[model samples]
Target: MLLPAASTVFFTQVFAGTPGGVSPEQAAATMVAMMAHGAVGAALGATVRLSFDRASGWLRQLRVTPVPQTSVVAVDVAVGMLLTLPPLVVVALTGRFLTGVRLAPGEWAGLVGVLWLGSAVFVALGLLLGWALEERAAGGAVGIVGTVLAALGGLWVPVELFPSGLRAVAHGLPSYWYAEAGHAAAAGRLPPAAAVAALTAFVPAFGALAAVVARRRSLPAVAG
Candidate 1:
């Protein structure tokens, strides 16, 4: 997290002061978007971990323990949420001190809080993939999946830089809305209704799908 934040700050510094230099506000917005990207993409590891546990029969072993399956799943998602903090704090600090982008303390808190909450969509996605796919397949797919989501979501390049058609497509993605929410919060405003609605819809949709997959996967163990 620190490494990525440092690299972004370095790039922002290099580009500052030129004719087309990144403005402080743009840099701040980019940092906020990147924070959301890192938070959502962080769950890719949970996919791999879940796949490995399933492959190793650890999930099956857990069935014999006293802990409920819902508890196990909740713990995994909660851990993913916790993972978002490091990147959020690192990038917030990097933008504040290194890049000279300032936000009120309340704005910073709101920014972090929004991105952290929106991350549930992808965390659920990671869990769904882990539960649904083979270990080797999940491992191979996660990197490509994360990269594609980030690219299309406008984290790697600003949507403003994209061609018109691509920009239209970006508006439809949950990742795009996720970043939009970050941008809004960083600016000390409520996230757009579209962003809030998109995130609200995805969270439960992905979570329900993941839950269904987990229940299906556990059925064989229960019957055995």
Candidate 2:
């Protein structure tokens, strides 16, 4: 969770006097971006854990237990939402204490809220992966997908550094919007409407797709 924050510190220090050195301000934004990346990546655990649960037949058992499918999914989503916060809180603290970021109280609250909400896209994505893949494949898929999302979304490297074509492509990803939304909130502004809309659209899009896939597989029904 803190690995990305730590790496940001290390890289900023290493390049402090170089032409490529990051400004203290940009470093702070980068840290926030990395935090967003970590939160979404952590949310991917739902995929691996659920795949294991499926392999163990726990989901099948739930079907026989009279549990409302909506209750089951709500619990899973609630757990995933909770899982995202530790990194957000700790990393925000590190930014304040270690990196000397100084946002207003409202800015802090807005930033946390935006990032937390943005993670819903990945949480829904995790459920999709969970329903779609076997346990053995889920872990590797999460690793690859998370890394690719981070890289392409400009979480690891700024989109400013990308070629024009690639930057255009990055602008289309939810992860890119996720970090952008965080950055906007951290700077004391409402998140960009386009970003918020894209993320909003993706949650149900991924969710609806997951429901269809799960139904086709004859797994337990997933509540929307």
lDDT of 1 by residue, 15-110 (tens): 786788988787897688768767766866654478778777788888789999789887888887788778878888888887888899999899
The per-prediction tally of clashing pairs is 0, 0
Q: Per-candidate RMSD vs. true structure?
A: 2.6, 3.5
Return the lDDT, model 2, position 152: 94
Model 2 per-residue lDDT at 10: 62
Judged by TM-score, which candidate is best? 2
TM-score of each: 0.91, 0.93
lDDT of 2: 0.83
Q: Per-model C-alpha lDDT, please?
A: 0.81, 0.83
| Stretches > 4 Å off in candidate 2 | 19-21, 219-224
State residue 129's C-alpha deviation in candidate 1, in Å.
Answer: 1.3
